[model samples]
Target: MYVAVKGGERAIENAHAWLAEERRGDKGVAELSVAQIREQLSLAVNRVMAEGSLYDPDLAALAIKQARGDLIEAIFLVRAYRTTLPRLGASKPVETGEMACDRRISATFKDVPGGQLLGPTFDYTHRLLDFALDAEGEIPEAQSGEPQAAPVPHITGFLNRDGMIEQEPQGDATPPDLTREPMEFPANRALRLQNLTRGDEGFVLGLAYSTQRGYARNHAFVGELRVGTVPVEMEIPELGFAIEIGELRLTECETVNQFKGSKTEPPQFTRGYGLTFGMTERKAISMALVDRALRWRELGEDDLGAAAQDEEFVLAHSDNIQATGFLEHIKLPHYVDFQSELELVRRLRREAQATRQDQQEAAE
Candidate 1:
């Protein structure tokens, strides 16, 4: 049974008020608006949205402001707020093939149908920080290009046509919602993907790195990586057809892995997929590597006992909110528990000292 600490309510309230003052910082300095955070610190907002499992950038920015730039705390706030929202109708599966891509590239191919559009990337830039941005200056407008009239084809589609890659399974049945239902062991690919997409970015990245360092290595190649806006559609019961609701900026990464076929199948390439909110290419790529690693059993491959391959271990600890909550709880008043432990240790030490003295006296 959990006992409530009764005397610290006033202290807690004062602490919160002090925290609000600290959050505001110097009065001389300009206060940060939510718009600035939403526009300028977009990547942080994206990470919060992805991990929090909520797509509202405005709310994310507000949370960021309230949390005093503590992203994990912001994510915690967003997630807590998300739970109170009423569930609306589910949208139809997003057609990524119809995505209006801003950036699309394939490491495997020299040139794709839609030529590699570099799109705002830091790939080739010098690592040195620009001091010009430290002072107020009007930034020059970036060069614009004509929008591509043709839809960018997925790189994997070409490989699949030649029967080189393993085919993705098709199902119309609605997948289990991990948010609503308790996660069970032996989770299907859909459930696993849901977990990975919303999982802690650092944890996922580390696991992905481990795979590259030969922990259940699945020689993954970036078949394609694309960042774009896709239309979200929902079907109305009154209207027979689905209507476009909104657009979401998404980053998708598809990795082709070498798969020497089993007895029933032919030697073919397998695929690992990752899709995340906004331009989170690093997270998407990392998620793909980890996703592929977790597919060892499904692919009829040997269980290599890698941490990434352990689904229960990965899913259980991947949530930052859950992890931080458990970790931070130790700082709270555990006086009763600690006191019991202290008494036990003291009693054991006293008995041991008494027994030792008696033994020494008897020997003498």
Candidate 2:
């Protein structure tokens, strides 16, 4: 009695029209412009650019406007657009030491060279909502001090000087790109880092939390958490030199964790590294924790079989777009699958009833 619906093209057109209307609700209200989103919602733009693995603030803002402020959807739009662009040249590795810092802090040392410039953080802020925000309000001007003359020294270097930390081996081999090719298991530290940078912030945070709570426990201390702008450079073969391309805002974190002594070596502090696109300290810190947890095998520590310790599990489930797609797809038509399941349940029920009837007769 059921007739399958055809005319998918017409149905799609109608649905699109409805969606468009829904996207721009309340005609009386002023419509938001892409420029407005770009200028006013700079943080959102930063997040989209970071997660999308692209640096175009204008395009990210446009995507945000088109997506109605849905960040993940905006990231998807930016990522899709990024694939269409031509790859001209690869940039030179950025130097964080040369970073013009806006925000920098250290948890391990009481004092540092830069003197812990807490530029613009909400660390000490209360969570209470201000009613003044409902109406347009102006922020007070922040007091500025004398500019720091010297670049802040890395905290880990202090430990490294005394041979209290494991020496990081220098490698010239270029790491594999997760975006250009299919992801394979038993990925190296570089590949794992790439996955984590593009991973869902919440998922990484939760996994990092688990590690702190005795699952692959590593006593971590924030070596340095810095947010600043660093200049990007690219090497041109024709020019025979590297030239400055542009500057990018970045958050870099280095965590010092407890190390265990082995038969071959004395105990030394190990490190976890994290880098992200913008002023995202929590994500950076979480990333460092997860990074260290993933290094159990390389560091010769016992595998606790924790979620963070499993490279495949972390890398596979970290992508927000893939997770969202798989989760949201359930809303789509699954008539055939549901029908099969229904038939199976009915058949099993019939058999069970028949067996029960036979048992009752035998007892009687």
Candidate 3:
């Protein structure tokens, strides 16, 4: 029997060993603890949870460490880990009106029924880097605010009093998951919002930025933004009622975009929705704009064909894990294809050279 090259199993094992070594880096250095990652790299963890569609900060922190601080890679890690988790039935759709907010703010009105609360935000922080982090000793003034906290109220309830915005329709009808279904044209609001929440932060930000640059320019204002935990409940047919399943920390942004009073329509404010994991205002704001842009067709607005307005383009390449994988994979071996192209060009040049020589000789 003719023998063939084997050791595929051994090669994988050796490769894994090398990868583990590379992941560890310097041998003598104390490894980065998961606690350190969770506390210090919280923003990274927030992003992983936001894009991975999972709210477990501990798991997200671990993924960040495993990815060696590559945030996109960290997101991929979280997504892979998230997918393996067992399904525990569907939770009842979150009631945002009932959310227990930690932070809430509004930019739309000066003084509403509920006073604007500028919750925990980095907006007022100085731009200088702190040198204190270089030292091991902790800051003496680290005041841990009461671990036992009260739930803050939502800011949008004030606007609802005057009916400034349209009241959202409540439905027990199950929402479709964009991940499970292949994207079809004319996506419903639920499906579109689902994709946008898990979409790549950078790509979404760019599309949102483009709107300000004039392509389907949507004049938008932050109607409200809130961050906190909301109870996720489940309605059991057997139980005949809903029960609380768990809670999730989320940042929700609703932008009030410009709309004209049409001949048949009344002057009503349009909504741009963004709901993401953790305290991520910028991402939430960007998401809202992109969300609004995607709804142009449904809103009876002209098809400007803007990048943000293109559902197929935006939804298809929105996930960082998918984009990064496809983009980075191109760096791997493509030698065979390169060799064939190289030979084809070389043969074409040689033929051209002979043809030129023949023409010159005939003229002589």
Candidate 4:
């Protein structure tokens, strides 16, 4: 008895117009420029780029602006835009050892090769809101000091000297790209790391938290965390030599986890790795924890049926865009299905009443 809804097209058009007006906000306030977003809200831009799997800060800022500050929507916009661009050549993997670090710290060691630099971090700051920032003023110039030495050695290398840490086997095998190919279960470590890198930050954080709360608890220690810029190089076919294309800001984390000795292996600390665009230490650390948790099978640990331990579960639901698409699709018309269910429920109720009346008459 349900009639199909009409004027949906017009409704959608009107909704879009309203949305546009809402995005712009008050007419008295000036429109936000993409450049301003890129410079001022650089961390947000970094997050969009990291999740979007794209590096252009300007584009990320524009996406943010267009999406009205909704980061997931911005990430989706960047991802969609990424598909249209033609793939050129792949870049050579940048070496993190040679990274010019701005901020470097180690929880495992007191003093590393280069002293731990506490570069721009909010860790020590009080949570009080700085109302002074409400009125914009010129930022004071940062004081410059003696240039620190480069090529800081990884903390894991120290543990590796005596074979205290589990050694990761070096391989030349190319990793499968989740974006390019459909995801298959039982993903390798490289593939898992790649997925985690671009996975939704909040989702990954929650999964990581579950591990610490005794759901497949793996004792994790931050071995080293470094944030800095590294040169990206690519080999040109014409030149026959790798050339430095550009430098990219990145954050890398290495976590040392305790692993019990098994039948085939001696007891040693296993390592979990995380790397992301820009200074996203929390995401990197969470990623490392989740990455280690996912490796329970490979490391010869018990599965324990943990959410983080399930490869299929983690990889399948990690993408916000895919998750949102399916979740939001429930808003679409389901009148036919609802009507059928309604009729079935009514018939069932009538049948139950009739059976009750027949029982009463028989008793009488």
Candidate 5:
């Protein structure tokens, strides 16, 4: 029971002014440009775009700047702004097989077709902090390599050819848009994927960790993980054929999980798939693990009653914006509710005291 308070326009205006001032700090320092944030703080921009369910890097960077580097606040800003935009035609499903990969790796295979390209990765780097980055320093240019003539095929394709992994048939039905429609229980794989892709990274990562730590354990192996750019295409009414709209940088993870033979089906490995905007491999991998865990029922596995296995619980609580809004609302003007609670507690205490006195007098 939240009561609305009236007549604080002046205070609210003043607070807004103060907030604006605080957002831009240290007059002596040069103000950071949106371009700098877009390029330098790219990882932050990627996160805002992924969780905000918007892909515009410039807008994401601007949101980050306006939020004063508070990522969740930036995500909130992006989501709020996203509501005002008109819906253009949806793009045709991207062919990740055609990706111009920046990074591709496989823990399951040593010698793949593309030969395991390790583009720009931090995996091999020492954890030592470089003091040279404190001051502006010129760095040598990186060596370039010749582009591969052959397309990099997925590692899972190899297993599928041998009937070692469950095959996923392509679906032609349009996926439900959660933005326009309310989320319901027993969500389809597509809806679940949409929710997981835009879910809070920390929340998804924690759930994934729990699965790995023996909670509904589904022994998952990174069959293949790739980070790259793929072309987005949309069909025009006049053209009657899809044309390239733009390219999106994406991180995709495919995990192969152990699946014992069921009564009706032969023993074959199952897959967990995750795809996210920009280079968010950690989030992508986490999404994959959680996705696999949630498919336990459909996979004919026993109900371990894990948190990750609950579809309603995952979809409902995965949204940080909704969670934060509910949480932060409690801090605002609960005076009336508190007063009511206070009165009730006092009345109960007084009644108990009176009853105790009456009982004592009767005994005497």
Candidate 6:
């Protein structure tokens, strides 16, 4: 009888309608326009873009609005939509050395050649509630600063001067797309970074924080954090050459982690790299730290059984959608299992009663 369970489709449809009604909330208040959500709730949209691996701000904004500002739902929407998109081609890497940066900061050197630009950040602002925002006032204009020409020099290039850092070789190695391919063990750098990019922000942050707390302790310093738009170049078969397909806002974090330098690897600085979609600096920085922790084997460091050091643990539980889906799915019908357990309990009780009655008879 329990096997005959049905009506999942009906339940799903009703739930969707109820959700829509709930999102609207009485239909008397003014509806939140997509533009308003896009402009005002931009940080939420940035998160969606970062996790979804899509670069279109307008689409992300629309998804956020559709999701009623539920950022994870917005990410799901974007991810679903992207799945149907036709594959145009792959792009040549946007050279970080040639990135036209809006904000760039390096923690290593106090007086680097290209000076630190504290661009748009909420770092120093007090966390006090602004009652003026509740009154629906317009935001103030940004303080004007003189803009420089394109093609900003990278901080890493400056580090090349002292030769303190190990040089990363430029290669034509094709990066694997995690969405299309099943993730295998001993994942390459490209795959690991891809997984981290779409990983849950909070999960990555906590894991990164754990490293500071002595789990696979890697003495890490944020070498640089940069945010800006980068050109995506793709090869056109018809055109027979690569062309700029479009641009995307990105956050890149390079962490300088302490490595004791094994017999194989010489005593020099090792790198922990993170690159994520959009201007998600916190997530990007966390990604770098966690990435460094995962590289214990390659760096010749002993694995201290840290959560971040466990690739299986991190990748398996890092996705909010997958985690929530599996978690919430327990609410689905399990009457069969319940009934089976019920029968087992009843039989056990009956056997115990019979045994008790026999023992009573024997005693009598």
Q: Per-prediction TM-score, please?
A: 0.97, 0.91, 0.86, 0.94, 0.97, 0.91
* lDDT comparison, 5 vs 6, better candidate: 5
Expressed as tens digits, the lDDT of each residue in 34-111 for candidate 1 is 999999999999999999989999999999999999999999999999999998789999989998998899999977
Better of 2 and 5 by lDDT: 5
- Pick by lDDT: 3 or 6, better one: 6
Between candidates 3 and 5, which one is better according to TM-score? Answer: 5
Model 5 weakest 10-residue run by lDDT: 259-268
- Ranking 2 against 3 by TM-score, winner: 2
Relative to the unseen true structure, what is the C-alpha lDDT of residue 13 in candidate 6, on a scale of 0 to 100? 95
Give the alpha carbon lDDT tens digit for every residue of 131-175 in model 3. Answer: 887878866764455442444445555665687655567766778
User: Compared with the true structure, what per-residue lDDT tens digits does model 5 show for residues 215-290?
Assistant: 9999999999999999999999898898999999999999999988765667899999999999899999999999
Model 4 score (lDDT): 0.90
Total residue pair clashes for candidate 5: 0
Clashes of each: 0, 0, 0, 0, 0, 0
- Can you tell me which runs of candidate 5 are displaced by over 4 Å? none
Residue 21, candidate 6: how far off, in angstroms?
A: 1.8
The pairs that clash in candidate 6 are none
The 10-residue segment with the lowest total lDDT in model 3: 142-151
Residue 94's lDDT in candidate 1: 97
The positional error of residue 284 in candidate 3, measured at the CA in angstroms, is 1.0
The C-alpha stretches of model 4 lying farther than 4 A from their native spots are 1-6, 357-364
In candidate 1, which residue ranges exceed 4 Å CA deviation? 361-364
Model 1 accuracy (lDDT, Cα) = 0.93
Report lDDT per candidate: 0.93, 0.87, 0.81, 0.90, 0.93, 0.84
